[model samples]
Target: MGDIIRVRGLEKRYGEVRALDGLDLTVPEGTVLGLLGPNGAGKTTAVRVITTLLRPDAGTAEVAGIDVLADPMEVRRRIGLSGQYAAVDEHLTGRENLEMVGRLYGFPRARARARAGELLERFDLADAGDRPSKTYSGGMRRRLDLAGALVAAPPVLVLDEPTTGLDPRSRIQMWEVIRELVSGGTSLLLTTQYLEEADRLADEIVVIDAGRAIARGTADQLKRQTGGERVQLVLADVADRDRTRVLLGEVCRSDVRDGETERELAAPAEGAATLMEVLRRLEEEGIAVLDIGLRRPTLDDVFLTLTGHGAEAPGTARTEEPAR
Candidate 1:
C-alpha cells in the first residue's frame, strides 16, 4: 500500500517539554500503523499535528497529497480523528447526536437523518437510538464517538487510544469495529499504550519514546531484535529451582529468569544447540519438567530490551513530560 500520511523532522514543544523531537512517521493507504509508546512519548502530539488540530513549531506533515501546514482545511476534509475521551453530547439521544454531527458536516436535513440511522445500526446503537446519551453505557458512548468521526467518511482515520477505559469485551468490540473500518480501505493511524492492541491491529508498528522513533517494524521483526530463541521451562517441582537456574544460565549467554514462584524460568538461548545443551543438563540434574519449549520472542521482550521498560498497563494516563 502507498503511504497516505507522511511526516518528517516533526518538532513540537510545550515550554521545556519537547513533545515531538525530529520525529518522522508514515502510514500507507489501506493499512493500520500503530504508534506505540509510554507516558509522555509524544504520540498524542503527533496525532494533533497530523490532524491539523495543533500546529508544530517545526517540520512537515502531509496527508493524502495535501501539505498539513499549507492546507490544513483541506487536510481536515480528508481525515477523521477519534480521541481518548468520547466526544459526545450526553443531553442528546444517540440518533440526535449522530444527526448533529452529520449536519455539521454539511449534510442536508433528510440526508443527515438517513446517515444517522445508518450509523446507529452500523454501530449497534439502533436499539438505544432514542435514549439520552447520558444513559448509555461506556462502550455505547465510545461507539457513538467513533460513529461521529465517521459521519463525513473521511479517507484517513486517526484514533488516539479509543479503548482506553473499556472492559475486555468492550475493547474487543471496539477492535472489531476498527478492523471493519480498515478492511473497507480507511487508512488508520492509531496511538495506543496497549501493545496487544497494536499487535493485533497494526500492519506495522512504530515504537516512540521521548519524542523520538526508537524502533519500527512488524511485531515479529521487532521481537527478533531483542535476541534469538527463548528456552522456557516450567519444573514440576519447585525444589529444583536453583539447580535449574544454574544449569540454564550456563547454556544461555544471558542470565536465567526465575519466576517469583520458582517453578518456572526462561533464558535467552543462542539456538537449537543451546536448547539441546539445556535439555541434557536438565536431564542430568534430574529436574522434572512440566513443560519445556523454545519459543520466539514477544513484543513485551522487545519493549523491555529497547527502552528498559515494559508496556504500560491498560488505561494509564501519560501526562508526565520528559525534561527538555
Candidate 2:
C-alpha cells in the first residue's frame, strides 16, 4: 500500500527542551498506526506537527501527498482529527454540533443536516442527537467529537487518545466504532497511552522515548525484542522463600524474589523442554513447585526495556489537559 503519512527528520523545540528530535515515520494507507510513548516523549508533538497545528523547527511532513507545512489547508481537507478531549460545544445539541461542523466545512444547510443525520446514526447517537452535548456522558461527547471530525468525510483520521477518560463499556464502544471506521478503509493515526488499545486496534506500533523513535514493529515483534518469556512461581509456604529462591536459582538464569509471596524468573529459552528442566530441578531439590508457565512478554515489558520505565512509573502522566 502507498504511504498516507510520511515524516522525515522532524525536529521541534520548546525553549530548552527538545520535544522532537529527528523523528521519522511512515504510515501506510488504509491501516491503523498507533503512536505509543510516555508523556514528554514527543507523541503529542509529533501529532501536532503532522496535523499542521504546530510547525517543526526542522524537517518535513506530508499528509496524503500534501506537504503539511506548506499546504496545511490541503492537508486539513484530507484529514480528520479528534484530539485528547472531545472538542464540542456544550450548549449545542449533538445533531447541531455535527451540523455546525458540516457548515464550517462549506456544506449547504440541507446537505449539512443530511450528513449530520447519517453520522448520528452511524455513531449510535441518533436517539441522543437532539440533546445538548452537556447532557451527554463522556463517551457520548467523545463520539460526537469524532462525528464532527468526520463531517468532511476526510480519508485520513488522527485520533489522539480518544478513549482516555471513558468508562470500560464506553471505551469498548468507542473501540468498536473505530474498528468500523478502519474496516471501511479510512487510514488512521492513533496516539494512545493504553497498551491494550493499541494491541487491539493498531496494525503497526511505534514506540517513542525522549523525543526519538526507539522502537517500531508489530506487537508480537516488539514483545519478542524483550529477549524471552517470563516465568512466575508462587510458593506454597511463606517459610520456604529463601530456600526456594536458592534452589530455583540453579535453574533460573535471572531471578527476582519478593519474600515468600512471589518469585519471578527470566528464562533465556522459553519452551516446554526448558520448563520441564526447571520443574525437575525444583523437585529434585525437595522444593514444592506451586505453579509455572512460559508467559510471553507484554507491551509493558517492552516499554520498560526500551525506556527504562513502565506505564505506571511516577511523574509519567499518559494524557494531559489540552492547552487552553
Candidate 3:
C-alpha cells in the first residue's frame, strides 16, 4: 500500500518557538502511525498543520496524494480529525452534534440524520443519543467527539490524544473502535501521551523531540533500543540478594541493577532462554524468590531513554497560542 499521509520538512513556528521544525513522517494506507513525544514536542502542532487547522511556516504536507497546502479543501474532504479537546456543542444532543457535522459536510438532512444515528450506535451512544452532550461524562463526550469525526467515514483519520482523560474501561473501548477502523482499511495518524494506547493501536511509531523526528519504528523495534529484555525477581529473604546478583551476573548480558524495591533485582537477559537459566540456577542454589518474570522493555523505557523524561512530564505545552 502507498502512503495516504505524507509530510516533509514541515516547519511551524509560534514566534521564536519552533513548534514543528523539519518534521517528517508518513502513514501507509490501512495502517496506524503513532506520534509520540513529551510535552512541548510539537505533536499537536503537526496534527493541526496536517488537518489544515493551522498554516505552517514552511515545508509541505499531503493527505491521500493531495497537497494540503495547494488543495486544502480536498484534503479536508478526505480526512477526519479529532483534536485534543472534545469539540461538541454542549446544548446539542449527541445525535444532533454528529448530524451537524454531516450537514456541514453537505450531506442532505435525511442522510445526515441517518449517518448520525449509525455513528451513535457504533460508538455506544445510541441509548443517550437524545441527551445534551453537556450531560455526558468525560468518556462519553470523548466518544461523541470521535463519532462526529466519523460521520462522513473519511479514508484518513487523525486523532489527537483521543482518550487522554478516559477511564481505563473507556480507553479500552476506544482502542477497540480504532482497531476496527484500521481493519476496514482506514489510515490513521494518532498522537498520544498514553504509551499503552500506542503500543496497542499503532502499527508503527514516530517519536518527536523539540519538533523533529528522533525515532521511528514498530513498538518492539523501538523497545529493543533501550536494552531489549530483562529477567527480574524479588527474593524471599534479603540475605539472598548478593547471591542472586552473582547468579544473574553470570548469565545476564549486563550487570544486575536494583529494582524499584529493596528485595528486588533486575538484569538484562536475551529472552526466555535466559529466564529459564536463572530459574534453574536459583533452584539448585536453594534461593527462593517471591516473584520472577521476564519482560521486554516497554514504550515507557524507550520514551525515557530517548527523550530524557516521561511522556507526561510537565513542561511548556506545545499547543496553539496567539502569536506574540
Task: Please give, for residues 236-266, the per-residue lDDT of candidate 1 as tens digits.
Answer: 9888888887787778866776543468788
Model 3: per-residue Cα lDDT over 239-322, one tens digit each: 999999899999885778777677998888888999999999999999999999997666555655675444565243434321
TM-score: the better of candidates 2 and 3:
3
**Tens-digit lDDT track for model 2 on 179-256?**
989999999999887767888899999987767788898877776676556555665555666776666556665554
lDDT for model 1 comes to 0.84
Worst 10 residues of 1 by lDDT: 315-324
Where model 2 places Cα greater than 4 Å from the true spot, the runs are: 227-299, 311-324
Query: Candidate 3: which stretches are off by over 4 Å?
Result: 232-244, 251-253, 257-265, 269-296, 307-324
Rank by TM-score, descending? 3, 2, 1
Alpha carbon deviation, residue 158, candidate 1 (Å): 0.5
Q: Pick the candidate with the highest lDDT.
A: 3
Point out where model 1 deviates above 4 Å. Answer: 227-242, 246-264, 268-300, 310-324
- Name the lDDT of candidate 3: 0.86
Backbone clash total, candidate 1: 0
Q: Top model by TM-score, which number?
A: 3
